[model samples]
Structure formats: structure tokens, C-alpha cells
Target: MELQQMRYVVAVAETNSFTRAAELCLVVQSALSQQIARLERELGARLFERTSRRVRLTPAGAAFLATARQCLQAADRAVAEVAAAVGEVRGRLAVGLISTVAAVDIPGALREFHQVHPSVRISLRGTASEELVEQVREGTIDVAFLGLPTTARPEGVHARELAHDRHVAVVAPDHPLAGERAVGLRRLAAETFVDLPAGTAGRMQTDQAFAAAGLDRDVAFEVTNADLLARMVREGLGAAMLPSAYVPQLTGVVTIEVTDAPARVEYVIWSRSGPTPAAAAFLALLGIPAS
Candidate 1:
């Protein structure tokens, strides 16, 4: 069987949906299905039991899945090893990060990488922490920089921390409690807050902290951009709880330390299996050790 067919098998098995697997492999659904069918016919057994609602592996398919994965992994390693031997980093590198991430100087790092490896084509995408994690896990992006809550860690990925800081509350200078050294969630129950929308990692972190403190405050404004949130606070729109680095943009807003707030950790994450040569070179340029 060809390596591409083996790759198709592993992808289908992992996702459990032919359509999704085809999308992940960057191929047409019909072609992928026909190739897998051809492999099954050659093996003289039905590998997958397909129903209308779901796709599942038959006994033979289950037994062959492990070998299929191994073959794909081996092929990947073989290519990586040869690329390493060639000592030329010239390929596509896809990197994802959150918009509010200030832990690493991404622009500066990219500039340096371009100077060092001019032949490499670099692509960068700014997105939310949850989305970044999903992209890295799926190998759509070679690496991602993520800001994670204290209680959260990415699964099935290799992560390297670049920075760590704590969350703080910000409000207009004339707002009540602006001069306080530190504030607690219990004292802010009646206040309206400006924050990120639900489902984002930053929002999830703050929500968990509020839930743990047994306080439910009103979110008066929801913004995805850090500068916009800071502007909302500066304009007396509302108060907000945000990461330390994202606070300085609130020029006129007063930042009050949040007591017992969850710590925010920034991490450089990649697929656990391996990183492409271009990705490895970019990581090295950023001073992150090889995974």
C-alpha cells in the first residue's frame, strides 16, 4: 500500500468521519473513500463498517489501525531525517497565536527568522487560545503560542512556556474602588464588567474564578480585542478583568490587582509527534529548545 493511503486510513480512524478525514488530509472525500476501499479489497476484508450516523472500524480494521499509524509516522520521520541531513530549512511554516499575546515578541521573532532563513515561507494566524490549541493538535499549524488559565493544560500536545503573569482588574480612574490596593470578587458583585465573549480561554478563566468565588457579576460589554476592552474601561463603559500585559493599553484606566486571581501562563505548543523542519528552525530562532 502507498504511504498516502496509509495516511488516509489513520486520518479516517482518528476522526471517525470520512468527510472530516478527507478535509484534514486535504483531499476530496470520494477519492479518499475509493482509495480506502481499494486497500480493503486488496486485503480481502472489510475494514470499516459504515452506517448512516457513524463510521467504525471492523475487527480487521481495528487490528490494522496501529500498523497504519506506525507506517505513517515512520514515513514522516524518514522525511524529517533526510531534511535534517540536507541542513536546509526551506518550506512552509504555519504559526498561530492569540491576538492579545504579549509574552513573546512575535513580530521581532519573525523578522529574525526571515533574516536567518530567507528561503522559508512563514504564515502567521492570530486567533483565540482554544482555536489555536485545536489547530496545533490537528497539525494544521506547525506551532502555536497560547495563554492558558491556571487550571487548564493542553492535551495531546508538547508545550513550552514562554511567560507567566496574573490577571488584574481595570476600571475608569473615577470609578469606585479605583484607588484600592487590591479588590476581591465578592466586592464587585454589583458592578458591570467588560470582558471577552464566552468560549475563549481568557473568558473561561475569568468565569471559573467568578464561579469559584460564588459571585455572578453582569458583563456589560463583550469584546474580543484587548485594546477595545481597555478602551471600554477607559471610557467609563465598564470595569474588566484581564491579563497583566493587556492592561497597559488602558491609558486612563486604573488597574487594581485582583486578590487570589488565577495565574495566566503563556505557552509555545506543538504537535507531540514531531515538528516540520521549518517549524523547528523557527522555534530555535525564538530560543525555545527543540522538542
Candidate 2:
């Protein structure tokens, strides 16, 4: 039936009480009852059964409720699409990103986005790659950027490789291996390593590379964020394996390429709800070759 009728039906179904539903719908109980009655009449079915103690949906009402929700959702989406088309783009865009993106590019990108689309609000939340993907699937974010396994692509989300980062080993400048041009995988077998926490994409990739090269190194410490990881490397807590770009020019720390490791690439992923103009514009500035 009509979108308004669907809204009324859903409100009644959720509250399970006409009086409370009407209050939530911001209308009088009598008016809401009239709309529900009209909807049932149009469908030629009895929608809800009422008794002294409580209200319950009839079998027909239960069936109609599912379709009613879909109708209401579609209508709301239509309104949002129309607004975006007119360049009025005046809604919130929620984004989920890995910690490094927020630390590396998000602040600058968001600054530029705000300058051009001041009307569109943004809420940014950062987490590990797996967590960010879950947020996107749950409809908590409009999009995400993270590094994850090429295997197990999530349904209904488009992922694109943005840039490749060579995972490097960071050692203090005065360390024994610092003078070497490149650190071979076998040489690092017995070295004390500092790395990101376990169960992260970075850790998994590191493990895979070490396994591939027949290398096994003892991890001396685990740090969570890029900045801190870099600092710990500088302090000589241990040599670390992390994204090359994240390595800082600490006085004591030097970056050495991993001779046998596969590079970790950053990926841009968006919910299939489709990209908004603001998100697209920011991506353009990043020089992402294609949408």
C-alpha cells in the first residue's frame, strides 16, 4: 500500500500497543487506528487482534509487516537519493577506517572534504581491519579503508587495492644489522622482533612471509598503533616489522627492507549502498586511479 501506511504498520508492530505506537508516531491514537483500519481494508485482511490484556498481530499482519518494512526503507532511501542528486548532499556520512588511515591520511582528507562539502556531516571511527569490515556490513559505516586478506571477500561490499606498502624491519641505527643494505629473511630468524599485536592483518602477513622463507624469529614485544610502534623501535625495545611508510626518522631507528616478505597493500572498500559524492571527491584527491 502507501508508504505512510507502511510506517504506521511498522510502528504498531514494534510497540505492540496502539496508544504507545501513536505516541511514538506523534499522532493521536484514534488517527493511527483509522490508518491501520484503512490499510487492512485495502488489503482485504485482518491485520491485528486486540484483547483486554495485550495486542498481537494476526498471521496476515505478521506477513504484511515484513513487506511494510521494505516499503518504508525504500521510500526513505529514495528521499536521500533525491537530495544528493540536487547537490544538497546534506546528510551524515559515517566512515570506518583502520588506525593507520586515521593516523596517516584521514585527517587531511577529511579536512578537504569539510571545506568542499560543509553541509555534509562526518563521523569517523577507527579500528582493526576485521572490525572495520564488520562495521560496514552492519550498516554502521558508509565506507572503509583497511588492509585485509585477499581471501574471504565480504558480500555486498566493493574492495579495491589503493597502494602497496613494503613491510620493513626497523632497527636502531647502531644495531649490528643496521649497516647492511637489506636484511635477509634467514638472518632475522633468531632476532628479537617487535610487531603489531597478534590476530591483525600485519601480523598474519608477517607470519606468512616468515613461513615462506623458512624463518622463525622470537617476537620480543607487541604494540598496537603505528606511532607507538615506531617509538618503541626507536627506543630499542626490539626490531619491528611494520608498514614502511609508518616508520619514522627516529634518531636511533633505521628502516631496512625485508628481502623475502610480501608487501602489504592498503585497500579502499565501500558498502554497496553506493558511494556518496563527498566520499568520491575525497578519494579523487587521494589519486585513486578509478572509482
Candidate 3:
């Protein structure tokens, strides 16, 4: 019935352990358990099936979980709106981004945002661009930075274009194409490549470009991390096509311009419903006007 009890239920359900949820909620395990017990008694149903090995939500708990989260989000937004009205920005800011984000200096921007609004709590998640867009739409993430093909745009969210760049061929220093000032996709397609996993936005750009050019290439390795992809390229596992802006940060690899390279666009996206005050402040920092 109480907000705190609902919070306890939500925390326990998410963590799947009373002990871990207690740690996250900054409450003693006994206290959190006792509160949830009280809540269950009041609700006249058991919310969780607790076993020594694991905790699972009961049917009733599953039904309650979504509403509990919405209530909590609403409460937090109410408090944040009140603070905003008083010229204060205080709330949680959950930001998501892809690994190949070269358009924005994320850490530097976060540092500056924190310095200006020390009252806000900030968290960052790194994931594939499509997932970031979905998370933004779901409201789980307050804002996101994404890199997608120039032909694509994040759907169901408010997005602002940040930067546009083309992919460059990355090869080991001793590779045959390393010394080339520029190469066309037809030439590069014959070499083995290392790229992001199939179906990801990052991979789709290259895939679509090659498919359009009627060229078929082998991707010998699929990596999720940009740094790991660079390492793979450096060790001569395979060549990689990465954003030109990102290639400058890698060493032990040679970057060659691709005449028919796939173009990528960077964007900052937020919920279409409207940004929270914290998200609004961050967007303002990025020069995006409130909508």
C-alpha cells in the first residue's frame, strides 16, 4: 500500500533476491523483507515465491510489477516537475549509447552536466543503437546517443542529428590495402572483414551498402565492442569498416578512405512524451530545444 513497500517489491522483483535488493535500496535485508511481508498481508496475496536458490515473482506479483513501476515513475516525475518549477533540476538521468559513438564526448558532457546540476543522479548504458532507441521509446532511458545509417532514423522518439560521417577501411599495417590513400568497396570486399554482429544497426549499414553494390564479403569475426574490433583488425584477423571519426582513436591500425563507403549519422534521441527536467537540461546542453 505504501510507496516504500511498493519500492521494496519492485526492487526485490528486479534483483530476484531480498539481500541484493536490500543492498540496492540501502536498507537492511530484514527490514526490506519485513516490509514486503506487510505489503503482502495487506494485499491478501503472496507476491513472490521465495526459495533458497532463487526468487521468482508470483502471478500476482507479475501483475503488480508494471503498475508499481509506473507509480514510482509518476511520483519521481511529480517531484522533479515541482523542483523544475522552482528553477532546480533534480532527478535521475539514465543515458544510453552505442559503442561507436564518436559524435559526442559522453564522459566530458556528463562531467559538465554533473558539475552544473550536482543534485541529479546520472547513469549510462552502452548497447546497440537499435536497443538504445527502443529503450528511449520505453522511457527506461532518459536520453540516448545512436549511430545509424544515413537512410535510417530512430522511430517513435524525438531525435536530433548530431553528426554525419562515412566509414573508412581499417587494416593492419602490413595488410595489402594499408598503404592505399583510398580504396573502393569493390576492392575491399574481397578481403575478410571484422564487424559488428549481424542485425545490429552498425552492421546493417555496411551490410546494406555491400548488398546494394552487388558485392558479397565474408565477415570472419563479429564483435560488439569497438575497441575489440580494432584489436581484431590490428592482429590481422580481418579488416573492419568503422566511422572515419572513430578511426583516429585507434592505434596499430591503418585507416584508408573508402570511395564507396557507407555513410552513418549520429543522433541524440529522447522520449516523444517529453523529457524529464534532467533530460531536458542535458538536451539543452547539447543545444536541442525543448519540445
Candidate 4:
């Protein structure tokens, strides 16, 4: 019932060990267990099923965990908001970005944010654009940078386009197409390709381009990392099409313009409901007006 009790329950649930949870909470194991027991008695439901070997959340505990987390987040946000009113921003900022993000210098931005709001905690993660969008909606990520095909836009979130650029063909220095000034999708389709996995946002842009051109390309290498994709091209394993802005960062590959290439849009997205104080400050630093 009490917030302290909920905190203990959450810690136990996350660690799955009463001893570890006590350590995390900076309290004795017996004290943490006693508080949880008291909470369970008040709720008339056993929150966890504990055995000699391990501790697991019971059905009732699983049902209550989500709301407990939301409540805790709300309480923390309330405190942070009050602190912000007094000219101090104190909260956690979780930022997500696609692996190929080039529109914004995330490291520089984080450095400035830290200097301005030294008390705020920040974390960054890189993944696919779609997964980042999902994380923002789920409240795990406060803000994100995304890249998607020009024809596609993020749904169910607030988004602002940052930049747009066409993809260029990259090949080994000695490859047949390396000396070409420009080529079309059809020309690239004839060569084996190295790209992100199928069904991902990064791969979709290239895939849609090929599909629209009535071409079927062979993707011999599927890699999640952009550097590895460039490596594959450098070793003559396959050719690749990557955003123009990101190409300069890779070495040992020849970049050629694609005359009829797919264009990708870079966007900054946040929760539609609103942004946390730390996220709002970050957006402001990026010159995006508050929504």
C-alpha cells in the first residue's frame, strides 16, 4: 500500500532474489521481506511465490507490477517537475537512436545537456527506427532519432523531420560499378547486396526502392551494424546503399550517387502525450519548439 513497500516489491521482482533486492534497496533482507509480506496481507494476495531455490512473481504480482511501475514513475516525475520549477532539472533521460543517425551529433548534445543540467542522468541506445519508436511509446525512451523511407512516417507519436537525403551505392574500390558517376536502382540490383535484415526500417528503404523499380536483388549479407555493412562492401562480399551523410564516415569503399535512389527522412520523435522535463530541455537545445 505504501510507496516504500511498492519499491521493495519492485526491487524483489526485478532481482528475483530477496537478498539481492535488499542489497539494491540498501536495506536488510528481513526488513524488505517483512514489508512485502505486510503489503501482501493488506492486498489480500500473495505477490510472490518464494521457494528455497528462487523467487517468482505470482499471477497477482504480475498483474500489479505494471500499475506499480506507472505509479512510481508518476511520483518521480512529480518531484522532478517541482524541482524544475525551482530552476533545477533532476530526472533521468533515456535517448534512443537508429544505428545510422547522422543528422544530430548525439554525443555533443549529451555533453551540453550534462553541462547545463548536471543533476540529470542520461542514457543512450541504438537500434532500429521502428523499435525505437515502440520504446518511446512504451515510455522506456523519452526521445529518439529515427530514419525511415520518405514515404513512411511514424505513427502514434509526435515527430519532427530533421533532414532528408538519398541513398548512394557503395562498392569495393575495384568493383565494376565503383568508377561509375551515377547509377540507377536497377543497376545496383544486379549486384549482390549487404544490408540490414529484411523487414527492418533500414532495409525497407532499399527494399522498397528495388520493389518499386520491379527489381529483385540478392542480399548475401545481412548485418545490423553499418560499419560491418561497409566492411562487407570493402571486401567485395557485396554492394550496399547507404545514406549519403553516413557514407563519408566509412573508409575503403567507393560511393557513387544513385540517380533514382530511395530517399530517407531523419526525424526526432517523442511521446505524443508530452515530454519529460529533461527531454523538453534536450528538444529546446536542438531548437525544436515545445509541443
Instruction: Indicate the worst ten consecutive residues by lDDT in candidate 3.
Output: 132-141
Per-residue lDDT over 185-280 for candidate 1, one digit per residue giving the tens place of the 0 to 100 score: 887667898988887997888888888888898997899878888888888888888888867645888989988786788889988877778788
Candidate 2: residue 7 Cα off by (Å): 15
Pairs with backbone N, CA or C atoms under 3 Å apart (clashes), candidate 2? none
Per-model CA lDDT versus the true structure: 0.84, 0.74, 0.93, 0.92
TM-score of 4: 0.89
For residues 1-291, what per-residue lDDT tens digits would candidate 2 score against the true structure? 677778888888899999999999899999999999998999999899999878889999999987776566456556656787886655666777776552247777878778877877889987788777766665557668887544434456777776666777788777887888798778877788877788887677787788878777888788777667777777777787767665653445887887875567677776666655555555666665334
lDDT of 3 by residue, 107-160 (tens): 999999999999999999999999998888767899999999988999999998
lDDT of 4 by residue, 1-291 (tens): 788898898999999999999999999999999999999999999999999999999999999887887788778789889988998889989999987889999999999999999999999998999999998887779999989998899998999999998999999999999889999987788899999999999999999989998999999899997988998899999999999998988999999999999999999999987998999999999999758
Sort the predicted structures by lDDT, highest score first.
3, 4, 1, 2
What's the TM-score of each model vs. the native? 0.71, 0.67, 0.93, 0.89
In candidate 2, stretches whose alpha carbon ends up further than 4 angstroms from where it belongs are 1-79, 101-104, 149-156, 248-252, 284-291
Which lDDT value does model 2 have at 167?
A: 71
Between candidates 3 and 4, the one scoring higher on lDDT is 3
Candidate 4 global Cα RMSD = 2.3
Query: In candidate 1, where is summed lDDT lowest over 10 consecutive residues?
Result: 72-81
